[model samples]
Target: MAVTVSPSRPHDTITGTPETGSQLTRIALIGNPNSGKTSLFNQLTGLNQKVGNFPGVTVDRKSGFAQLSSTRRAEIVDLPGTYSLYPKSLDEKVITDLLYDRGSAGYPDFVVVTVDASNLRRSLLLFSQLADLELPAILALNMTDVAERHGISIDIQALEQELGVPIVPMNARKGIGVAALKIVMAERLATHPVRFWEPNDELLPLVRQIRYYFNLHNDYLALHYAQQYRSISFLSVDDRQHIAELVAQSGFDATAWQAAETIARYQRINEVLLEAVTVTRTEKREPISNRIDKVLTHRVGGYAIFLGILFLLFQTIFAWAQYPMDLIDQGISALSELIQSSFAGPLVRLLTEGVLAGLGGVLIFIPQIALLFAFLAVLEETGYMARVTFLMDKLMRPFGLSGKSVVPLISGLACAVPAIMGARTIESWKDRMITIFVTPLMSCSARIPVYTVLVALVVPDRAVWGFLNLRGVALMGLYLLGVVAALGSAWVLKTLLKARERSYFIMEFPVYKWPRWKNVGITIWQKVSAFVWQAGKVIVAISILLWVLASYGPGQRQDAAEARVRAAAPAVATAVPDTTASQELERRVASVRLENSYAGLFGRGIEPVIRPLGFDWKIGIALLTSFAAREVFVGTISTIYSVGQDADLGTVQEKLRAEKDADGQLFFTPARAFSLLVFYVFAMQCMSTLAVTYRETKSWKWPLGQLVYMTGLAYVAALVVFQVLK
Candidate 1:
């Protein structure tokens, strides 16, 4: 395909590309869920993409640079998917806000509406709405390949003429016709030639008044402001108030008007599709997806299959990730040993025991994190996750959660911060709040380090009945425990909270297809990198802080303690071999030095409180540090043990496994390890999760309530487990 740039835009003389400092044109990709919109965004942007929040909302913003031509480049923004302009949830409201407020940073110069070619009628509703708003949009007839396979055909030229905008039929997943789409984008196509909807005569006068007052060119845009002025943040208070008065004067019936407008748009869409689209059936047959869904979504079979899949997923995470994790653990140990031997100073200790220890603790789990995300990405791309959501709706509904809440709950398994933000898509205020309240109970990937380490220490690695890994089963049980806790909490919140608004779950099941490997790879890269970087920063800071407290004490207390330990040691006989006695004396000195340090003082202060749960001062220290992030627990324990021990360096797991109590039993006993695991599952350990909950709810009450409840629950649960198991 040949590309051409509009003459209006300037270019660099030598390379024929846009001028070095010139701003790139902004293009927005809008589509419904499962419309292949994200596939196209990935194709256009590739590795140049980033994810963030829109200006004032928590809805995700995905944007990247795309080279449309030698002289033209576009900054493509992937907006949250929505079916129509009418806002039903916070995610959908972002679409309306960005499109209506030209002053918003994310507002686009042009729109690319990704239309599912197989579902043209429903997809066109949004495209038609954009046309009425007079946004410059091009129809991306995506999923054309899938449509063709299902006996659907479309006339691209006829549809282009009917919508009065350029149409590009392409399989975004396969990169077909992308070049043609780029060529069209480089042309700076005009808005659709026809207006698809206009306010009826009764509302026309009011719409005209709004248009004139706001100096807006499109009547539909002005009408939206009139209907949604209260919620539109971009509008000035005075302007909104005036609009409110005008609406009052006109006695505007917003619901009736919106319904009438939707009916009219569909009427126009029907006429257009009648001329441009055709579906042929040689014989009556059900789709392969439907046949598969019969078993995949069956009332009882679906749940069994989901559980089986989850079991396999967790087992694979453990087995496949072990080798790489071992390599990482070994590498970090080697580096620490080299650092210790090559240098001698407080800085050296900090480098090895502080930064490296904390960083290494999180890094060793990258393989496991990547594996987890890879499985999730495959399920999502294959369109099986939607079925899971549909299947779980019945079970969740009884717990006061809608099917829509399933996405966030599942997402919480990866990270609670974003998952809490994901609750925006749940339309009901009551359901969304309930989701936010209980989502933190779902164990996240951050807890993987703590879980793996604890499980390895207590749970046997050998297979049960020569098939299932006992360790894997323990991990699954931890995750399932989190789910059960979340549901039970949700049920309790349902009873406590009162709501008059009824909740409904409406969802579409996308056709099953092979997972797109590129998309899966991107998802894995993003999730893993985010974990390492975000968690790395917090861990590094805490590691340095903990090292200072662990290394020294106030007013020479550490020196005094060491001196007392040496004085208390019995003299060894020079005539007889006493190596074991000497080593034991040295170990006693190391332990005394650490116990008197500031960190030890702090931990001892909390020991009495956590004693009932079978936690020693060391475990108490870990519990406090891990509140910043659950993964930090491993690093905290590593640093504490490293600073306190004068022995050979090893992996955190090794150090923890070798830990012993005064009575000579292992410190992390089966009862205590599982008790800690259960505590973390119920704890509000991530401050970021609390912060995000606050941002999403815009009130301190919800986050404060969540923190108090979850922490109390963790304490009680841990106490019970310790008492029962011990």
Candidate 2:
């Protein structure tokens, strides 16, 4: 392949850095969607990457720290991928605004342009746009292995000459050419000056004019030209209509200049390809992607497949997780008992019954939730997610959501926090808002404990189809009910907030590829760690507070109760025996302390109204305590019921079943448990979620509305469920 090399400048000088970057080498990775930009970034940054949101926006951001060599550690930031410099979505705006707004946190010292190997023409359009920006960049031809396997080869030397930047051919997926890329980077960092060149051709005048108008007196003319070309300028000719017309009559063939610029850029690219790239014609093999897609994407068959996939997920959580949950539960109780036996003080009770038990409750679900994500990541990476989205699009549109909304909805089965965050990918403002509103309805992992206890009490564990268990399916149905309610609510919101509607959806159907294990591992690590950090603290604090309130009472409460118990002791040498009378006295003493204590008073205050629906003062206390998290109901009720009995140990369901009301009738019957289940289904019982909602929406208003509306609905539903069932 022949090449054109502009004679090397005898000596090039390095440019001055921005004030803050005096001690750090800052590099940014930029490219169009599906250009292997993220893969390339993962290669460079590896395990050092971090995912965070941009300040004051919901857009996802990723940054990582890496060492370029033994002595140089550089900071790499991966900007959102965009087609052109023009901003369309809020996400694209993130990149464009940050680049132009020099006041941004860490502006890049260098940019890396990644191009897909198969689609060179479309890829070059963006490359040419970036080149005119005059930023120091290295254009890497990613996915070269795919191209080479297709008997295609790109001329690297010629492309480097034509684009005025180094061209590194590499397969990011295999780690090939990574070291070669590092060598080029090191050379650029050491010998070559950070260089941004003005295009040596006809497009220079328009670049100058646009610079004069939009940014008159600006110094970086070349970079500005590239920015405008990539930004909205190219999309609508009318955007630059006046300037374009004015330049037309000025007799410089302005339109021709821009056209010639486009033509020559491609011309040189083709000539470079003709010189360097060689195509050895070979018979293409049968694609496995289509073969697998046949059954997975069929309309009727696909629906069956999706259900099967969902069934497998639930079965694993419901059936397989029981063993670990039991072990974790036993471990928590054992640790608590050991602490209680070791010491004799309020501090021992606080540590054992409060913090340790509370933390265990939250962490116990980690295994099942992590498995759910692992399966989802595998499905998503294999490219079936797009098909799922396509199939669900029509069904979801009525609910004001897109197929993309399903990601968050499915993720909600694990936790609602990340599920809501995942909604950021939905493009339309209306659709995204709807997805966020309804995600919590999808029976999160937090609800599992409550559901397990209620289901065990109310529903029989029976079998159906071979390998299909009724209890597992019932759990799945509860999840599905939440989904149905969420979609129904969204339908109402869509009608209420009817702003505008259109069905134009633009999305990239990336080629089906195996799920990257590293990406999945990173996701699980981040989500699980953050979940523990955020919810663990709140639960622990609340548990400790409840322990204090329940353990000790004021004035004569403990004294009176202890004296009554002592009075019940059988007659010894010096004591009078009053067995039956003393037993009755002790019971009466306990009732008085429980009535006057803070939790007791609060419970009694709410008891009159709830008593009609079959809840005792103890149940009232559990309900109030559980507002921190809905699933806390099981543990709260378990503790309250256990407090009433002589036995110090038993499972939550056993305690709930044995609990009886003053009428001597069995409490927590099928009817009462069903009511409790309904209450949990719709309750606003998560403070962390409210905080996230306020943070996302930027006001206290929506979170307040959410609490009132959801809780009111839950109460009404609970009342109805109990009355009807009874």
Candidate 3:
């Protein structure tokens, strides 16, 4: 069998030689999920990292610059974790695509495969596959500390000899053995090696034919091209057609061949492990993880514990964050007053009432957002998140969603943008689409401020059961309502959008461990920072825009209203003979000016439509502004009421409490507050979420449908709640 070798291009080798004067070497870090890959990446890259989407896919691509040595700098790309090159999910496919397509921008010069030292048997499968690709590879044996606890040991030299790769045993969580790993990476990037795995007799002839036709130097590379030619993005139409014809002629059954390859690979792995790995001791004892999983995964006890934890989380978010939230609010209020006192004119009003008020609204929610993200990060770091998914899978399946949907739905509580992005893991289109559709219905942290303000207005803060605060209980009820709505919507979607193929959910349950505080802190920082920066931009812009609309109107209506209020002020004061009369006159002037402003006109136009839901024109204006983001509702209300009421210094909630309707009834009556709460719960008010939905679905149809259905539901539900309560 004659195999034609392609010319040795710089891009062909796993550790490609850098071009003259180019000081950077590109390295790819590949690993199975829960193999401590991200921990290692964070340790190596520190703050020099950037996250982006992979080409032609929504899956995240994280890359960072790492200084391997004094003179050696490397760009490390952290490829999504996968079990093997034959991908079962979209994220896993990223690994195969980048590796098989040398023309890909993410194509690496060398590969560092991180494997769990405690689970060598399972981790070696991917390492072996990489070796078969004829790439220069380093094995990073992470979690060695955990392996020691389990009485597992490995002979490093023997493993290196057996696998024909350098094995660096490291505890990534503690930053151990990282220096040794870097040194090995720097040394191995200088060499190019041939394929490590020899093809079996049955596959050799076919591999040779593939190599010859494709001009491939490596047999394994040819094998992968034969298997994945159709899905490989780098292949041209002509190349794919030629490869297809050649593959057809060779009578290659991709499924059968892949199965054979896997079995053969495992057989070789057993041999390697036999010579290299050792079980230092075997004891008849239950693992700590297994012992804990018994209770955590128990049918009755599990749910009780989960509910208790959720209650505690909400309680903490509401209770612990109250102090910080108040501080932020006061600081922002003081700053706004300072800015107003210092500057005079429209710019000052815009700065204090518009921009600063909008920012204050967003920043006040930071305490809750940070707390929620911190809890989520801790759950994920402790590996308890997987158990939650596992527990919810049974419930999720009945709702027409795959087990994978649970992850997105649970994460939706934080933010729908990434949660919707997370739906990519669901292989079934119907399941993924349904997950995206209903994810936003879950009240996110953005809704926290709105919910807190409204709930505090209506629900008493006293404890319900002498321990559970009524406020916390109300918050939990809102969260539960969202979950019910999501599942109900998914059920309806399932009945409407029929599936052509069967859906299957497969996931790995990682062993439980103590949460890594550093990883948890990094995750919280990233999420909270992204939230503030992204939402802050929209909030500030909307605040300024709302200010412009509310400050000025057509035909000098605002000027006319202000002059009329000034003309009546002296007569009203003479009749009333009290300071309250003067204050009421000023309040009336502010109300009249707002009623005649552009924002008021727009709100009145929609008032008839939303009036049955107990929403007046002012609330209607807030509804319009909040579409940019839900948290902007508070800012919109604050800005509208703040105009001309400069003397009445009050928080958004206090101002809302002071608002009165045409009948002299409180605008935020319990009925109105509850109705508004219900409306926000179901409304598709977030434009960012809609944009993300479009990006994920690659069409406006789904997001548009989502907006219409959710908005309609909100209106109808709010109407019913208001009518019943009123």
Candidate 4:
């Protein structure tokens, strides 16, 4: 096959000048899943990437800026991977909508369709479809090295001629052909206007009528507009109605036309593959991945291995993060002390107790958060996460959940907001809803700080088997408790909410490979940074508000209480040394001010309600404040203790350890600590989570029901634990 080289028309009329007037060229990278598309994108864009959601959807949108040449820069968007333009799932629909709707924000001027060299026929189906759309596209035959290893050879020139597009053979992972890929992208962006596919004779009149009606660019695009007019958001309601009427009048059956188009595209793909590709082997031995899967996916062994990995992950997170966490704590404390000594009065108090303290509370968990993201990224990059989902399907089905539900449930450990969003992929509504409802029962990162503090107090630091640290084991137990609670609650919900439709689980497992360290690092950076920024904004605002509320009272009550404490100071000085007496006087003054403050009044008001769970007034305050977000429990405790700005978790723990009730008994005994842990495990304490749930469900009824049920379960469970242990 011989091809002609033609100068394709530029997207806009500007020649030798930057497109979009200083705006970088917008190029979209799209391909089938596991086709090395993301690897190519990562290589091209490096660290200049940002992740967000597409308009009106929860699916992730990843884009990055790449400098293609000295004078040429491009913004590349990595759309969700899909097998075809025809939509089956929400993610696939997103890709189709973006490609079909030219007015959409993510519409690209040029497309780089990544094709897996090892699977030419299957990968090129999407390429052919894009070609049919009359869009200028570059074919990136990625994973050439893998194809070569598998004894597959491609005639690049012949394939390019057959497909009528620029073909670039490159290994994206090793960066072997990245420079050539960039050169092709820049050239194609400047000039590419060849339409490879032509409409069939039978559909010509329908296509022409639609093209004339809508002023479409070509016949293929018009055909798509006719077939998918309902889903095409760019078209108005009246336009869609008119198009529908026109299609009816022309005898265009969408399903039959789609089927005929698919078959014709496949026949063309097979011809192209046969002409340009060669396979040396007639038969192949089983791959290493299959051999490994036999053992890892075994019913009993898989569960045990999964549990062992889970334990080790938690153990590593707790054991390795301790040193860095301590350092961060000490550094924040030192900074707070410097601020306190450098300033004076209410300004000092607000900065130290309000801003710095709140920041310290959230920043202290950075080490754990980074480690968690790193592990999860590694698992995903290695393709082990897919296997985990497959392994979990059998276990999850009985609880009215799909294997897909495992994703959201596991993601809940990081945070529930996105986890609930992740549940949208589950095709079954009942399974999706149940997954969302019970996901919050899983212990999230917000609850980790609280668990660590309380576990340090009650659980011993000794080892269980010389290799397993006792505290690590205890942490694993807490995580397991959460998993058990989530599954058990899912079971109960399954009974209450009848499934309207049966759901089947289908997933493709990518071949296992060594994790790309660069991608893993990027994932970790993105997740940790997002967590800090998102949570930090809320924490800082609430901290300042809380400080004011805790600092002031209804009237002169705060003034009168401070006067009483100061009046007794001199008499106390007669008995004790002057420095000790002054220090005690300062402590007494702080305590009096806190007790007479509005926060104190509120805590006391709620004391009787939480008293059954062995919570004191101070804990009552933390509980109320934590309803906004669970992690605020630590910040609230730190504020209420009136500890120095230079206080660490150890300082707060010591303060709580020494705290006594009216009967002079320790406040945080084993029973109380366990009760508090149990309460947090089951409580619907995060307003943000509830808000997300409401948004996902599109109704207040579900979120309201969740709050009542989860909170009631927490109260009853905590009450029982405290009553039995106290």
Q: Where does candidate 3 have its weakest 10-residue lDDT segment?
A: 1-10
lDDT by residue for model 3 (1-726), tens: 101111222212233464335557788999988899999998888777776678876566778888887777888899888888887656677788888767666678778889998888889888888877766777788888878777787777667667766567888888888887787776653233323366677777777887887677678888888898877766789988988887788788999988887888888788888987788887678777888989888988987887788778777876888899899989999998888788899889988978887788667767766777778778778888777767777878888987668767876886786677556556666788889999999999889878988998888879876899999998899899999999999998888996444566666878777887887777666655665665456656766787788778889898898898778677757576578777666667767787788888999999999999999888888888788789767766765665333333235568788888888978899999999999999999977677667666656798899999999999999999999999
**TM-scores of all predicted structures:** 0.82, 0.77, 0.82, 0.81
lDDT of 2 by residue, 1-726 (tens): 222222342213236542243476777888888888877788888878776666555566788876666655667789887876555565666676566544457667777788888777767766665555555677778888777766776666655545556667887766777776665555453122122233454545655766566653333443343434434312246545645454554455534544655676677556656765677776477666667778787889988988787778767756776788788878888888888887878677678867886777567756655666666667766777777877678778877788888777877777676566556557666687778777777788788888887888768778888688887887887777787878887888778765433444566666788878877776667556655665556656776777667566677766676566556544551155366555444545555555556776678789997876677798887777676667666656654553333333335667567777788878988778878777777777876566556544545776687778677767888898889888
For all candidates, what are the clash counts? 0, 6, 2, 1
* lDDT scores in order: 0.80, 0.67, 0.78, 0.79
lDDT of 2 at 268: 56
Q: Per-prediction RMSD in angstroms?
A: 5.9, 6.8, 6.3, 5.5
lDDT of 1 by residue, 590-615 (tens): 66666777877888998999999999
lDDT of 4 at 433: 83
Q: For residue 675, what is the lDDT in candidate 3?
A: 98
- lDDT value, residue 73 of candidate 2: 62
lDDT of 4 at 282: 48
Give the better candidate number (3 or 4) by lDDT.
4
